[model samples]
Target chain A: MKLKEIAHSRTGDKGNISNISLIVYDQKNYDLILEKVTPERVKAWFSESVFGEVIRYELPNLGALNFVMYDALSGGVTRSLSVDKHGKSFSSALLEMEI
Target chain B: MKKIRIGAGAGYGGDRIEPAIELMEKGDLNYIIFECLAERTIAIAQEEKLKDPTKGYNGLLEYRMRKVLPLCKEKGIKVVTNMGAANPESAVRVILNLAEELNIKGLKVAAVLGDDISQSIENYMHLEVLELKNPLESIREKIVSANVYLGIEGIVEALENGADIVVTGRCADPALVLAPLVHEFGWSESQLDLRGCGILAGHLLECAGQITGGYFADPGYKEVPDLWKLGFPIAEVSETGDILIEKVDGSGGLITTATCTEQLLYEIHDPSTYITPDGIADYTAITMEQVAKDKVCIKGGKGRVRPETLKVSIGYKDSFIGEGEMSYGGSNALAKAQLAAEIIRNRLPIIGCEVDELRIEYVGFNSLYGTKIGEVLNREHTLGEVRLRVSGRTKTRAMAQMIANEVEALYTNGPSGGGGAMQSVKEVVAIGSIFIPRSDIHVNITYKEV
Candidate 1:
């Protein structure tokens, strides 16, 4: 099953950085989930041209996944308030990843 | 000159409205601030959004907003809040609908966006700025959400743009009120002393009614009175950063030095290292006085330099978990449950599955209070229950299924087994933090005329 098809996810704002959590439907597919889902894969899925860092968290009890992407906010954190940077919100196509 | 009295509410999660409104009604307050996010609350918010996208914003409880917004609009008080969890624009849409329903005019609602980072996590990890003790490991696949608790500068920009009701995503709670105070007082961002003062003021009043009497009630705790109508806290911050922690007159609870000290000590590990997105506040220099029945005047808080690294919260995919429970009768019930958990642990691996954390709790035998009691006769052993819990990072639904299946097998193969068997196990996910350098992290504030 696709990641988006099976997991429940949500995103938050902090300039270019965003947090995403996903819950798998079946426990048996966890290893398959991890094997297919990697930081490099996620980075490629989300950004057209990679810039900054991606951090992840593993919560066993909640059956969920969390990701922190930094410098995604254009101009990095310092220019988070400038108007030119606000237009760079995360693309919805990247949000439709299947892993 | 008229005093621009701004009021900010405090509390963990979404419990800041009633008291904020009460203070607005009685104290002639000009601005109201509400703090409603924490670590656990964020988890809960994510869970709610999973059920329904619109339900994610926990602070938009109508009961809380209904009591306060109308009055603030009538009194010409501008309201600002970070109650906008996953969806600030949707929250703003709701507030504007409320304004229309109330027949209130010229209520401009603006949503401060661009903080959603769920899509760009991978790119962030590659920057080499995030310092993690462990290299991106197995958990990197489990990340569900990431949001940096932002500073108050964004709120200042929104206010400058003439937005009366400024709604934001995840701003540092204390900055909600401090931003307005900084703007109204014309305090410069470079004034470390003034900024530190604002941080101190925000800290004191952040946990609405907490400094007064929400969590730590004195010896007369029972007589605190009308807790249902407990007022949220309001910070009367000055240009110098001194704040008066008070509530609406005749509101429930008392504000005293003892209460203020108790609140200050809440969740505080080190008094000298109270940090916020705005700056680091020094609680060591704080002094509190019971200025009135419901007023505690706080002053003399100093500050130091902020850290060059920004704290980052990251999560990744782990394992799945499933749990169940069973009850037993008779005196030897407690011992049987203990043996059962051990048997399952030893037996599960044999069947090709590994368990990470396995625990069996004796519900009726002092499990919660941290007291241990031995299995004995003669003493009345009221109904007892055992909760078998297990966790693993492996892909083993059968492990959980087998544990449950074996629990039923204990009815015949195990000793003194009379009760029914239940199965419970959960998947494991890892959560850790990485620090991003100041030079690597970027933030910008701009103005958009409405």
Candidate 2:
């Protein structure tokens, strides 16, 4: 099953970096997510768009994991020629990751 | 048992007005906060100011004041906002005049200035821009606006001086909500924990409807009811900095632990250390629980001492973008779209443009993913139609417009079934960040009463 089935995500941007938060609907699924969703896996999953390092932070209380991807916005909303200037669709793109 | 009710109104400059009106009418709000300015907005507003001094503030400030001031007077609700994008003093005057026209008595309006550091920006040319490798000197000629992200100082001062409406430029989004908490409960600079909690509350409330299910709706996955009539969020805060985020009773949108958790992580990096001018917030300890229907209580946020320096956003003229789109349908639609893209690619150079970068995409297929989405996308059946989009970035506006003109010419010159052509050309305003000393920046507040 896809991560979207058990978890949801939202993408935000600042400068050239993009931050995506993945949260599980159930607290029981947090461990499964934590075990499978490693920073290396995420970096490889988004290898096409993400260039710089990917840092992952754990929010145990909220059953969520936040991933900060650097050099992700193609120089950000101002100069990015991408149709999705703010990378809004990246959240949906992240949901496509299989667990 | 001291508590206050604050409504989140107008998350951005172009936000919906009806939800804010709903809050004003029925949310029973003691205060309403609107966080409207973006990083690139003030730079564009600064350019507009050069064209007309009276027009630098948010374009909808007049319309918002006209709609909310009369209700504010009747309901005795205070207003705080960063709608004064490039000019706060002028925004103050606009509100004062709006009060007179509406005949709303005893309304005091205040404006916070000094966020604009452009005149003295030369002194900081040696500082390193956080985003770019270049120093300030490289973009000095292209600089249009430079403004600091102020904390609660200016807004708190306005509230302390008995101003019913507070207007400011370039204040941090969380500061718009945190300032009122400081003024009402007498939160001191040393009360870092409470300040942290308040800033966290501000962050959750800053985006308005996002906390109340505007962005959380997914058809079969996560369901949010009555999303079309989405309601903005309201925060009920105790003196100890505990908060309950909810919306008006019977109003649309859902408020649950899930929604609250999503919003808590939205637009934030380093959840443990969120640095602001007022305090450095630690969100790791935060806990959310559903206390009642459409309400979630938040608690246990940590905080540290405030930063010694403030962040400044620098806006500069970047470049120009030109784009055009045309669609082709019927048999061999994919082939036609590919041929159209090839034709445009060959013709863009012939048209003569100093192109820095360019993209040719088929709208239904590769525009978003930018490449093949595995064999599934390739294993298509009965392809109907595809739109070809060509976009380019150029240093000159004329050169950029030439790309759009060339694509437009494809209708009569190149393709057979190309239809519904659309094009656009605009100047790009980019943003840069730098840290400046707190002591070097000054804030000035002016108040006027009706």
Candidate 3:
């Protein structure tokens, strides 16, 4: 199943760093998400677009995983020339990742 | 068991005001706090203050205060907002004047100042932009506003002094919520568990309707009802720091575990160590329970020691962005839009325009995901109509205008059947973050009666 199949996500940005959180609908899917959605995998998924590091933090009680993508917003919202400057759609883009 | 109900009025500087009014009227809230003034807003507000000192507060201050102040004053509901933007003193004066106009007597308004640290930043030996690692001296000439994020102390002081309305500048969002809890519950700064719980409650209510399913809806999958009349969030916080989340009765939207969980993790990078001015709150062990419809009970928050350094948001003149867009419809629309984007891409170099960055996107196809959607676009798809958007940023307004002009020329030059051509050129005030010692900043709270 894809990440979006059992989880929902939201995106927020600070400077060039974009933090995307993925919260699973059911607690049972936590292990699957933990195994499939690693920082290394997220970095690979974003590849060249992310200039800095990708860090993932887990909130086991809430069944959520937050991925902080550094240097991801091109150069942050006010400076970025991209249409979606805040990287708001990055969560949807990450949902496209197959499991 | 002393408990107070608080409502999150406005989330951003330009957020809808009607929902906040609804919250004030129906939520039975003791405090209605507006979390406006983001990093960039204060910078722009500072520019306004430089020209006319009294004009630095939020643009909607008068409209909102006039509508809600009398009602709030009558109901004994304390109003707290960071709408002061670059000037809390000016905001205080505006609220006081409004109170006089409404004939509302004995209104206590408090203005919390000292967040602005423009002079202090210059004294640092070699300041580096947090996360970005950029040198501070590079953009020093263009710095418009530099304000430190004040914590709950100033707000708590204001509330303790019996201020009916509190206005502040550049305060941490959660601090607005936590201050009331601290003032009401008499929670000391060392009560980590209690403070942590307060922080959690505040974070949930900080974004107004976001917790009540405004931004949580995903249509067929995660359905939310009556979003058009979605109600902002209200938190009934107990003296012990326990919280029950709900919305105004009969208002639109629903709150469940899904909505609560999504809000808990919003904008948070590290759940274990979420830093704020008051202390470091850990939501790692956080848990929530749905007790009833449109109500969630939140518990199990932990707090660590507060950081010695405070985060400062520095706003500087970035550049000017010029954008142009035109729509194409009927058969082969996507192709024509692509051709239109190509024309803008090629035109810039020929026109000798110096752009720091450039972006060309086919609106319906690849405007958001950029090249990442290449794999999906490779699959079978059909686009009946699409829009071509071209934008570029440059230091000079003339250069920015040239980029937009090139796209306006597309109506007659090429890409036949292009219509609704639009062009815009605007100045960009970018934000950078740095950490300064907490000792370097001092806050003072003053109150006025009307």
Of candidate 1 chain B, the 10-residue stretch with the lowest lDDT total is: B369-378
In candidate 2, which residue ranges exceed 4 Å CA deviation? Answer: B372-383
**Candidate 1, residue B156: how far the Cα is off, in Å:** 1.1
Model 2 chain B worst lDDT run, 10 consecutive residues: B370-379
For this target, which candidate reaches the highest lDDT against the unseen true structure? 2
DockQ of each candidate, alpha-carbon based: 0.01, 0.71, 0.71
lDDT of residue B81 for candidate 1: 73
Could you give candidate 1's per-residue lDDT for residues B36-92 as a string of tens digits?
765434544555676888766755545566676688678877777767666676677
lDDT of model 1 at residue A17?
58
Q: In candidate 3, how many Å is residue B240 off?
A: 1.9
Candidate 3 regions off by >4 Å?
Answer: none
Error of 1 at B227 (Å): 3.1
Fnat of each prediction, in sequence = 0.00, 0.60, 0.74
Look at candidate 2 and give me any clashing residue pairs: none
Cα lDDT for residue A52, candidate 1: 66
Model 2: native contacts recovered, as a fraction: 0.60
lDDT of 3 by residue, B1-450 (tens): 899999999988888888888888877889999998776899999999999977899999999899889778778899889999999999999999888888999888999999998877677527898745777887888888899999998899989889999999998899999999999999887899889888888888888888898877887679999998988889999987788999888888999988888788888888888889888898988779999999999988888777899999988888899999999998799889888888878888899999888888878777777556644753566777888898988989999999999999999986889999999999998898888888998999888998
**Chain B TM, every candidate:** 0.78, 0.97, 0.97
